[model samples]
Target: MSGEGDTPQAIRKLSPGRLVIASHNAGKVREIAELLGPYGIEPVSAGELDLPEPEETGTTFVANAELKALQAADLSGLPALADDSGLCVDALGGDPGIFSARWAGDAKDFDLAMRLVEDRLNEEPDMPRAAHFVCALALAWPDGHVEWFEGRVDGTLVWPPRGGNGFGYDAMFLPIGGEQTFGEMDAAAKHAISHRADAFRQLVAAVL
Candidate 1:
């Protein structure tokens, strides 16, 4: 529930040094690493360190993110940052929100996942096509101190998908008042307005 200057209590400030990115997703790791680039933080991926992916049994994004971050921090003995993000389609009643990745199945075939979303929407054509991306970021220290920040970007779902630059459901998500879908936009442009970027900004304000 932490936002800029709105934490429940005084949170520990993150000193620049080696930090772990608790995620096995390459695209996610890349995006987070890009955000940490300007800071004096050295980014390392959990997969790179051979960290086992923890079961995401949490009911909410913040809970899952905090769980991963704490696990990584404890195992690596360093500060760790974890991100739990997902696409929520309004028509689907926020389904596939926390289960976004699982929707991709075992192979993580996002193309198939996108098609499944489309098919689900087809079942209820009268439903609204509005959707959004949610990102919850958790920064945890080895001792268990943690801070969570969340961000969201509202958008519409487009059919047939577009572009191929971004990963997951980015190809079909058009940001509000935006001409290009997240997948169509370059990394720098997407980073400027993405849900992850929004949360990262809050993290920077409160802890960076």
Candidate 2:
């Protein structure tokens, strides 16, 4: 695997005008596109190219993000940006880290996953069921140059999910410095303080 400063032999440099976002999720793509727009880069999604999904076998967020970015760059012949994000609950011993997406099994039943989180913490009652969302972003050039950034938001989990705006664990996550859950906030509001947005800021700084 390529480490810091050691460019991959297979990758090539990204051109100046456009960028490819290595994700299939429309929500993620839209957010990233908006974030990168001010930098004057036209963002394209892997979903638009009908690219094959890359398997995320890496143990850490950085590893997974790099894996996806490299794969997308190779396939699309463009610079690719990828991110891996998940909620890590302290009460569960940081479980559901990488498995956050599969917590409710392969069906991706988020409702069941949220219920499971509640069930696991119900008995704790007074115990602090704190959690945090982590986002790791990777930017890979077709020529093998890659960089990564990480961002995290500490928060506690709410019992009954609230709001209907955001996706995943948004309804159950109350950020450390916020009064409402992410789902309770509008997209612009949530993006202003989200872990993904934090990471994206770093990405923009590096790229621009």
Candidate 3:
């Protein structure tokens, strides 16, 4: 993965202009679009492009994000942004770190993933099961300049997953300072204090 210093300041100097968000996930695309809305950047989603989903072969969030962003930029000949996010659990030794999405195999079976988390922690009732959602955002320009930003919200896992608002692990994860899981919060509420929102703040500082 490229270090923070590797990013060219020239990339930041470029106008916001039209930007492409390289993600097929509608939820992610919507969240990112909302975050970038204030900047007056016209955001387009990869799902709307009929582009092939690039394989995420990178080992880290930043790597994956950069890979996707660069690929999209090259494909569309436009500046692109990409984010890679996942939940990491302490008690599980981060078993689902990069594999968070595929924990239940290749079907993207999130229900099974939630069940696995519960089953894994069932034996260790006394274990301190702290977890966090991590988001890494990468901005790639057509000229190969790239920048990265990261944000995370530390929280703990709750069983029997509550709420039905957000997707994936949101139903089972509570932010550090909150009692309700992210899934319990409304979209506006979740966006106000989400890991993705934090990362977007950093991205705004760098680009806007």
Best by TM-score: 1
TM-score, one value per model? 0.95, 0.89, 0.92
Instruction: Note the Cα lDDT for every prediction shown.
Output: 0.91, 0.82, 0.84
Superposition error at 170 for model 2 (Å)? 0.7
Q: Which residue pairs show backbone clashes in model 1?
A: none
User: What is the per-residue lDDT of model 3 for residues 1-112, given as tens digits with 9 covering 90 to 100?
Assistant: 3365455233464376788999987878988888888888999988787766888999988889899999999989998899999989898887687778778567777889
Per-residue CA lDDT of candidate 1, range 1-208, in tens? 2533455332678899899999999999999999999999999999999999999999998889989999999999999999999999988989789999999999999999999999999886577889999999999889888888889999999988999998999999999999999999999999999999998998898887
Model 1 CA deviation exceeding 4 Å by range: 1-10
Candidate 1: Cα lDDT at 36: 94
Which residues of candidate 3, in runs, are more than 4 Å off?
A: 1-11
TM-score, predicted candidate 1 vs. hidden true structure: 0.95
Native RMSD of candidate 1 (Å): 2.1
Candidate 3, run of 10 with poorest lDDT: 1-10
- Candidate 2 per-residue lDDT, tens place, 17-130, comes to 767899887767887887776666888899889988888999888889999999998888888899898899998888688778778677767889899888878767676789
Residue 62, model 1: lDDT of: 88
User: Runs in model 2 with CA error above 4 Å?
Assistant: 1-16, 123-125
